[model samples]
Target: MPVLTLNADNRKELAAAIADERWVVACLCAAWCGTCGSYRATFEELASRHPDKLFVWIDIEDHADVVGDLDVENFPTLLIQHENLVAFFGTTLPDAGVAHRLITAQTELSAAQLAAQADSSEERRDWQHDCNLRTLLGA
Candidate 1:
């Protein structure tokens, strides 16, 4: 799926949508930015890989008011949110491999938290193993 476009009009809904979700990745970008345009395809691919997670693409120019509070200084910036909390930001869009690794890491971390919340020991253990293996493999 294409990255969901966010703006002042739907900022509240976007926040509410991601509030209880395990993970969300928001891309702060502008339409005229070449880098942002280039990264869109990869971002969409990642979003497709993890449909459960909210992938928001915000056009900084179009939604300056909403993003003004963020004080973002660069284009194509990435922010990873875990349960409505910003867990990571300023991660660069270097390449698809790097993007995949970052998304996988954040998703695994969020999954661990979700597993804990559900009180599923088996699920938690499985996530832990998955994380450990990913780390060991340098993914």
Candidate 2:
């Protein structure tokens, strides 16, 4: 499936997908970043490969309300979630293979494993509290 760009038009669909507990892979980028522009095609290709997961492209500057106060310090930051548990939230290399591997690795974890890992470290715990898209999107 193609990557869905977050906007007013499809915000409901994205919200519903998150509400349904589907695995969501979101790419957070800024419109003005050259790296983000170049990585857009790669993100799309990653989405095409992961048909089972919902892929969303979010421009932080354009959708500040949706993003809220999430500190996205780098371009192409990714937030991967299943239900309310944020499995991973951080910056990644722009390489498609790196992202592909990350998505695969995260998806392989069972729900219990994911939950355990969510609090396994201070950083991951912060992701659980601060980086939840469901909360950010008000879904």
Candidate 3:
């Protein structure tokens, strides 16, 4: 899919999409920044490659309230959100190869981390149940 020009119109739908486990790559930029303008094409190319991930180009000044909640301090801030958690953030945009690598690594790591958490929770529950059984049997 093409990079989405995020405005007030589709903001809620975008948030809902992200909340629904869809990965979103939000580029927080300002219209005044030359670099932001320059990277528009590159960003679009990246978005095109990853159709499953929603790519949103947000003009910081135009949407200060929403960007403020993101705690963006720089002009061309790249925030990658997978599901509800922010997977990556910072001013890493000069090298496209590095950016791609970082995003993919984060996505995989987040998946692994979540899976591990679920496994741990299941183990804890099983242990607790075993302990309860032991207590009932006076062991």
Candidate 4:
């Protein structure tokens, strides 16, 4: 699927995406970021390769109410989730190949492994409560 530009009009769709088994790869960025603008096409191409996943382009400045507290520290930060598990959340290098590898690795894991990671450390545990897009978007 193509990248979904998150906003009020289609939050319901985001909600359904969140509720699915498919991975939610959200690129948390800002409209003014030069790197983000250039990387948009690469992100969309990456999404096409994984049709079952839901890729969201969230301009943090525009949707601050939804992602404000997610502590996005860099442009093109990727928030990856599956079911209730926040598999990964942090700054990602702009290289689409690197993203491909990361997403593949995360998605290849079984559900038990993901749930274990969610409880493996304090930070990981916090991700379930804090950084989950489902919780943030209430979707």
Question: Which candidate number maximizes lDDT?
Answer: 2
lDDT of 3 by residue, 25-100 (tens): 7777888989889888878877877788878888878976555444566656787655544555567754567667
lDDT of 1: 0.63
lDDT of each: 0.63, 0.91, 0.63, 0.89
Per-residue CA lDDT of model 4 for 1-139, tens digit only, reads: 6789998799888888788878899898898999999889989999998898999999999998887788888878998899889999889999999999999999998999999878999988888888989888877
Tell me how far the alpha carbon of residue 127 in candidate 4 is from the true structure, in angstroms, after superposition.
1.0
What shift in Å separates residue 119 of candidate 1 from its native position after superposition? 24
Q: How accurate locally is residue 121 in candidate 2, as Cα lDDT from 0 to 100?
A: 95
Where is model 4 more than 4 Å wrong at Cα? Answer: none
Over 46-68, each residue of candidate 1 has an lDDT whose tens digit, in order, gives: 88887877788878778765555
Better of 1 and 3 by TM-score: 3
| C-alpha positional error of residue 89 in candidate 2 after TM-score superposition, expressed in Å | 0.6
lDDT for 3 (candidate 1): 72
lDDT: worst 10-residue window of model 2:
13-22
Per-residue lDDT of 1-139 in model 2, one digit per residue for the tens? Answer: 7888998788888777778757999999998999999999999999889998889999998899988689898988999999999999889999999999999999999989998999899989998879998888878
- Report the lDDT of model 1 for residue 119: 45
